[model samples]
Target: MALSLMLRNCPKLKGLSALSRGTFPVSRHQNFTQLVCKNRTALPLAVKCHNQFVKAIEPTRKMSADHSKLWSIEKLFSLILLGVVPATFICPNKILDNLFAVAVVMHFHWGLEACVVDYVRPIIVGPVLPKLALGLLYVVSATTLAALIYYNQHQIGIGQTFRKFWCISGTPADNEAKNQ
Candidate 1:
């Protein structure tokens, strides 16, 4: 209503409403430009000026099959873990221990990677900090995976370790007696 009233009151602006509606006369383009130049505030709403200093950034890739494959693998690992957890506890063996170690570490790495990517974004933090955080995440993930693999190879292994944790019912001597 205000716009209609404004246009009705100002004959100069009557063509502007038509221009916004796409029915602007071709001959009026020059007149519109002149009017816009004269009254900078009256520049057409549809007209946009681009800044040459700002370069357009395009996505580095259209689509990545590898990302989809990674997503599928992550989901598969998650599902496998559902069974692997119980199986490891039920029968703690070298194969199940190693499987548990690999799957758990990969699951943890993926989950932490997601957290780091989402929370430690360069836009939120500074560029340097995000890169540092990602590097730290990689280091931590690799260390954890390596340690688990080592423990599985040389020690009682992940499954047996967890089983031992559940089996702890008393003090050192009491537990030793129970085991004996």
Candidate 2:
């Protein structure tokens, strides 16, 4: 406690404290930290500019209501997915089939977006690549959803396709037997 008090009161002693780390007791580290913080040099211009850039681009959050609501919506999407997938497979209603295709495609798009956001982070893959990757993911997801909806609208339908997959016995003879 005496050494800590000395460190707080004397600026000259703070200089000597850096050289005596091996001899310094653990209790005095807090005082030493304050000395270092108080004596820090002005940051470089590049670092100062970076801080200003970050401040301008990303303001401090006040309450983040949008962030909280987004999390709840993600969970709600999950619950919808849980209901829509099995229901599509079990019963072959045309309306339910169309809903399943749209809902599941949306769910997959969100899931893939999360993966792209995580793996293609600007820090790791460079700033431009992450944005490009995200764009590409959006294109692919749009194409997939369009194709699924088109198939559901113009062909045998999504539900019947899934039913055929579920009921297939993996042999031409068995398929023919079932068809007849």
Model 2 scores worst on lDDT over the 10 consecutive residues at 17-26
Off by over 4 Å in 2: 1-65, 174-180
How would you encode candidate 2's per-residue C-alpha lDDT over 15-38 as one tens digit per residue?
433432333233444675554455
Tell me the tens digit of each residue's lDDT in model 1 across 43-108. 544352221111122213445456888999999999999999999999998899889888988999
Off by over 4 Å in 1: 1-66, 171-180
Query: Which residue window of length 10 is worst by lDDT in model 1?
Result: 50-59
Cα TM-score per model? 0.61, 0.60
Report the lDDT of model 1 for residue 70: 92
Clashing pairs in 1: none
Count of backbone collisions within predicted model 1:
0
Shift of residue 108 alpha carbon in model 2, Å:
1.5
lDDT of residue 10 for candidate 2: 64
